[model samples]
Target: MGPEWAILGATSVSLVLGAVVGLLAIRLQGIYFAMSTLALAQMVYFYCVQASFTNGEDGIQGIPRGVAFGVWDLSTDLSMYYFVLLVCGAALLAIARLVHSPFGRIVAAVRDSEPRATSLGYNVSRYKLAVFVISAGMAGLAGAVKAIATQIASLSDVSWHMSGELLLMVLVGGLGTISGPLAGALVLIGMATYMSELREWVTVVQGLVFVVVVLSLRAGVVGSLSGLMRRRLQAAPRVSAASLPGASAHTSGAG
Candidate 1:
């Protein structure tokens, strides 16, 4: 298994898993959808634990650092970094395209109003299921890539905590925005990587960050910024219109 092949395999697996989870989420909606996904992920975690190939507690160690194209060595850090970036970027682009498409709009509509969408002759549940599957597939892709990157797959990859962490990442970065999760993943992963000395306190730090974001920023960072930009854009046109010569006369006459 060359490094390129390994990465490709991991990415493909993650994409399928993400799509499956996304499909499930489409049906459940709100807290129900979340809980459903969490439960499903836990089932996977247990399965991995029981599976011999996963090595249970010890995890699948010493995974081969396969070569690149029979020419480039991926055992090196630089090559591996480039490979990860390329794969992740491709996945993100796919997600972005999905979000901007008509199907994506339908999914959003289902999120906003399933009953209304159904009334409009759309099979809301089916659409939701499809999207849930897609999201799950993407998540799986991420998991597979992660496993390959670390050259190991443990029960931890499918654990509820992993799912929770992903949710938190999206929330902190700004849900409903493509870039939010990427940013959130960076911050969370970076913190975890560098805070090895304070490993015991990492949980506390993470919890505090979640608390602050939930309390002070309901929309998450990106969402809040987007809202601010929209408000400013809207206000500019209003201000300009109001300042026009006939604006005050019209307002006074109406009054």
Candidate 2:
């Protein structure tokens, strides 16, 4: 199958699997839910490491960048990069739109106060499960894209460490914000790439950054900036049209 087909297949499979997992996972709350997911991820990692189809520890390598959409040759790095860029741009726009939609508002309400959401006749459990399934599908799609781009798939991808890294990205960027994940990913990846020579000290830097952000900016970088701008806008003095220099003169003249 081509890259497109592979992506579609991965999404479909993940959606189904996510639903199955969410059935039990969504019932747990807070730390229990996180631990449950971590355990599940560890199981998947072990399976990937032992499964013959996954090629054990070595992983599947030399994956071809099959033609995408029959129009674009994804074999070339330039073409592949542009394709990934377009996909990312579209995904970001979709996420923004989704977050502003009524459904998104309802989800937010559920997140803020589950009891209130339930009192309002919303199915909190269903919404949570739906979100989990959707997120899983999106993750699968991203994995497919990454596999195609890098021409390999590794067992480590299914490990809990990857999940921790993903969580770090969201927290660093701004949890519950639309653009936070992207910003976090870019920053973390940039740090890793540029500071490769720092060796084990790179992790120390990441830890320091995370700690500082948590202590100083509780809302995260983008979230804090957004809140600051909002406060400033509200604090700014408002100029009523009636208070203008010509307003009274014009009114008197009209009268």
For model 1, give the 10-residue run with minimal summed lDDT: 20-29
- Model 2, TM vs. native: 0.94
The CA lDDT at 56 in model 2 is: 90
Off by over 4 Å in 2: 240-242, 246-255
Q: Residues 106-174, candidate 2, lDDT per residue (tens digit)?
A: 999999999999999999999999899989988888898898999999887888878988999889989
- RMSD to true structure for each model, in Å: 4.3, 2.0
Question: Model 1 off-target regions past 4 Å?
Answer: 3-30, 69-72, 237-255
lDDT of model 2 at position 174? 92
| TM-score of each prediction | 0.83, 0.94
